[model samples]
Target: MKGVLVLENGSRFSGELIGCVRKGYGEVVFHTGMTGYQEILTDPSYAEQIVVMTYPLIGNYGINGDDFEAKRPWLTGFVTGETCDFPSHFRQEQTLDQYLSEQGIVGLTGVNTRSLVKMIREEGSLKGYILPANLLADGEKFDFPALPRDLVRRVSTKQTYQHSVQGESHVVLVDFGAKENIAGALTRLGCRVTVVPADTEFEQIARLQPDGIMLSNGPGDPADCADLLPLIKRLATAYPLFGICLGHQLLAMSFGATTEKMRFGHRGSNHPVQDLRSGKVWITSQNHSYSVRREGFPAELVVTHKHVNDDSIEGVAHSVLPAFSVQFHPEACPGPQDAEALFHRFLALMNERKGSQLVTTI
Candidate 1:
């Protein structure tokens, strides 16, 4: 079946519909990852956007249940240059088209995805729609549902949840729409995890007596979550705090720092980031359109990492607090292992803090 993707800026692309033959609307963005389409599609962070994969061929390895970061697909649509019809990986369970179509998610194949990516890079993420002409007319602009401004709220867990409480080290994950693999990463590092909603009360965590608190990656403008700043500020004072992606932005906000939207959001598996403390560079997986502004950061909060390409603030740690946050994902689901060591770093911090607390108590 044929489908038409109409952008708010009036650009249209026609392609073969491979996924659901349903109409959908969302903010259109692009990712440059060579692999991991399944993980990307299922990541809760991409909740309100249509993803365009810049890679020429997708789904070569096929889809499997194991790689999904969330329980289901969250995106408005998917546009790809090419989508594999027959997959070859041993773990492959189904083709990309079959999986998406079953989920009722729209997907467009054989699109000039490179051109779409270029447009997003130049014009930033924009609202768009995907639909069949029977349900919607081609090139006709409908009152496309607004791309959610409160993306974090839409994706965040409604109630506090827990997993793997059997481990020795107790960690409370403040789920600002955290990806599931992040919890898996922490469990692998010996953390007994208690996952909570984004605006969870600090007293609730105090009752649990956790050893560390993790601020998780999420979506939308950080300013919308202003109510969460007080909770983050209170929790960071009592325990080691580690943050990723949108969690990083909120941490900065909690510490009198500011965040701003980027011209074009970073949404790929291979972004280069530099560790300011070690002078080392690592390829990172990133998916955020906002970043912490160095100029607005408080003097006590020091920048710990920077983007190699644009020198944007990639990570920050407080000078006097056992708190830190990174703009890139360390729990790479569909990306390289170059940044995965950060999980060990968090584990080390937890160990060191526990040892110090024991000594003080003794």
Candidate 2:
């Protein structure tokens, strides 16, 4: 069926509706990854947004069960230049259109995604809608509601769960719409992981007797998560901590640092980041619309890594506390694994803290 993507600025583009035939509305953003559509679709960090794939051809490999980053797709809509109808991958379970339809996700194809991306870049991100072609001809004004402030709550887990039971170190992961690969990466590092809801209290996490804590990636602005700052501050003091994406922004905020929305946020698999301490560079996967402001950062925090493209603050570490965070995904499921060493760094921090406490007792 014919479809039209209408931007809040009154711009419209015609396309083919490949998924559900329902109208969808949200903030429009673009991703540059050439692959990983399945992982991107299910990532909770895309919640309440309409994603535009800039790579042109999408879903050539088809959708497989193993590639899902979350239980379901959280984005309000999907946009692509073209989609593969007959996928030939050995692991393929279903076509992208079939998968999106089953999951109630609306998708648009045959649209000039490059032009859409350019518009978002030139004007900053905009609110947009995906509707049938008939709606455009009606010439009626559309008033889309503002994106929700509680997107994290809408995507976060409601209960605590355990994984990697036999691993040595006990780590409590505060699940703010976390991707499964984050837990998988922790388990691979020999950490026994316990995932708790985003609003899980400090007392509950403390009771877990964790060796370390992880603040997970999620949707929405970090300022919207002001309530979590106090809990994060307390946890940072009590345990070794690591954070990713939105978690990184929130952690910085807890230290009295500020965060601001980007003109066009980084959302791709191949961003280059340089480690300040070692002067080493690594390709990373990133997906966030806000970043921690480098100016007036807390004295206790030190910048560790920076984005090579825009010189944005990509990673930070506490000078005294065994806590650190990165604005990119080190547990990249559909991207390069160069940043995976960050997980090992977290484990080393936990070990160092344990040895220090043992020596203090002696």
Candidate 3:
């Protein structure tokens, strides 16, 4: 079977089909990681997006049971220059073709990925469609619609649920298309996690009596989620809060900061970020297309981390509230673990608050 990727700008790239032969459409974005295809494929943050893998060879190690970042794949489609049909790994259970087919994801291979990535870098992310090559016409016009703003609601847990019940500190995780690793990291730190929907009410969360609030990474433009800013601001004042990726942008905007779209955005595992306070650098895993802007900055929030490449803001902390946020994935499901210590810091804040509350009640 053959397929073609048609971008909204009328750019078309032809390739052979490797997985489920069907049409897929959504925003077209790219990832720069050399490996970790499994985790990227299953990440909820890629929902409503067709992912172009910049790495030439994908699925060389194939798919394994342990590496999925979510229960299922959320990306609209997958593309690559080469798809490895035969993989060699001790833990490998299936080939890339088999995994994509099983997950019902459109897989197109043998395309000029470098040229495609260059177009994306120059023109920015574009909406696209993966269709059978036979569907092409002599002249085709493609118009891309705005992606739905309810992506968080579509991907979040419809009902609140507990990931685990055995831990000292209680954390209510606001699911803005959260990855499984976020909860896993907290559970490993002895925190009982209660996963809640993005639209969950503040009164409902207060009933849970959480020690801290964890705003999860999500997809799309941060401005589209402006409705949540007030809730985030309230949460910060009430509990120790840590935000990641989309959550990071939302947290900053709640404090009068703004966000802007990047040219192509960071979607790699090797992004470098420096802690401004410590003057220490760490390699981080990142997957977002929007970032907190630096112009007309808010004074109450301090810049705690910065991107080593373009000097973009990577993290921020409220001046008085026990709240902070980072634009990278410290859980490191598909990247380095250098920033994993941030989780420890969050737990420490929760513990400190608990001690203060105990003293006040006495």
Residue-level lDDT of model 2, residues 296-340, one tens digit each, is 989999999999989999999898988899999999944557688
* Full-model lDDT, candidate 3: 0.91
Candidate 3: list runs displaced more than 4 Å: 137-141, 333-336
Tell me, by TM-score, which candidate is best.
2
If scored against the real structure, what TM-score would every candidate get? 0.95, 0.97, 0.96
Put the candidates in lDDT order, highest first: 3, 2, 1
lDDT of all the models against the reference? 0.86, 0.91, 0.91
Q: Which pairs of residues clash in candidate 2, taking residues 3 or more apart in a chain or in different chains?
A: none
Q: What is the lDDT of candidate 2?
A: 0.91
Which stretches of model 1 miss by more than 4 angstroms? 134-139, 333-336
- Cα displacement (angstroms), candidate 2, residue 305, comes to 1.0
lDDT of 1 by residue, 297-344 (tens): 799899999999999999999899889989999988444585777777
